[model samples]
Target: MSDIATAAGGFRYRLWRGLDPLPSGLPTGFAALDALLPSAGWPAGSVIEVITPAWGIGELRLFLPLMQRLSQQDQYAVWIAPPYTPYAPALTQAGVSVAGVVIVQPPQPQQTLWSMERLLRTGACGLAMAWPRQPTPRTTRRLQLAAQSGHSLGVLFRRQHAGPCRHTLPVALSLRLDAAENGLAIEVLKARGGGQLPAVTLVWP
Candidate 1:
């Protein structure tokens, strides 16, 4: 039966059998940031870490547009251990479909990662966001494999003490947020692509 499906339409049809088509790379609402990212967009089938010392550092700001874009395309977005209750008004204003948002709260850090991995591997979700205290190497490896297998986007929100991950995969970026006179200052501490490394100051209007 499976062979017949593949023979009829090739691997593309087989890969998407019984599932919605996978989303393309993230659509950065901001053109400049989009260009900086490899593939000119967020990496699919990979784990991306968003680290911050505290909440309200505009970390959500960086993620909101991406989430909104994904939801706009009728894809689902999952949030694990979100710091606060998301304001529905704000999300709606940003063009995200509040209906498609799924929030999962896991009691333990390990459980959070486990849930995220499971969801990402299900191929039923387009994106999964988790705030894990300190992820272990074993957990990260598992999550990495799940993301690749499902071709899902995983964003791991880490605290300051999460420390340096020793994973073999190279760190794509390390961003630190600070308060600037204008607004929030985002410093690209480390990135794979070389450049002047400008600090982006974003003032929410």
Candidate 2:
């Protein structure tokens, strides 16, 4: 069940099975950033944390490539509790399969986490993304375990806060995104088998 991704000029990337030490991951649609990751892309079956100072800073753009690939797959790409309604036309223009994209908004914040865990643990979805407010370490750990169980990718987007402590979270990867002069700057805060690396700048996807 290898997930295959083909890039421009016939380049291909292969996703490996989930393992304890991590394995080759799915392409993130950006070659420069992929070169910086140990798995060469987003680690499959693991949770990733994206921390930003504010919204609309190209945070969603970073995952657009990955979303496009996952959405078109046999499984669904579920988005839980998005900040705003996703614009279909814009997503279509980005090469995403609208039919494969599903949105779920829970009335209560706690329910959002529960929904994300269920979807990720079902093995029926390729990816599950959420924007949870005040996620405790226990909550993240649960999400991580669920992703591992289903071999799905889980993304948690959080706003930058004062005195932020990323060490408390059990996510497999933690990245800090900031707006660069020409494009977006992705700083690798924490990664499996690696420490903080230099930021990689690339045009918005």
Candidate whose lDDT is highest: 2
Ten contiguous residues with the weakest lDDT in model 1? 10-19
RMSD, candidate 2, Å: 6.4
lDDT of 1 by residue, 1-205 (tens): 5466447753422243454333345665556665444335666776777667777767777777888877767778999888788788998988889988999988775688889989989876788988876677677778878988888788887666555754432334456677667556766665544324676666665
In Å, residue 65's CA in model 2 sits off its true spot by: 1.0
Model 1 clash count equals 0
Candidate 1 CA-lDDT value: 0.70
lDDT of each: 0.70, 0.84
TM-score of every prediction relative to native:
0.74, 0.86
Error of 1 at 40 (Å): 1.8
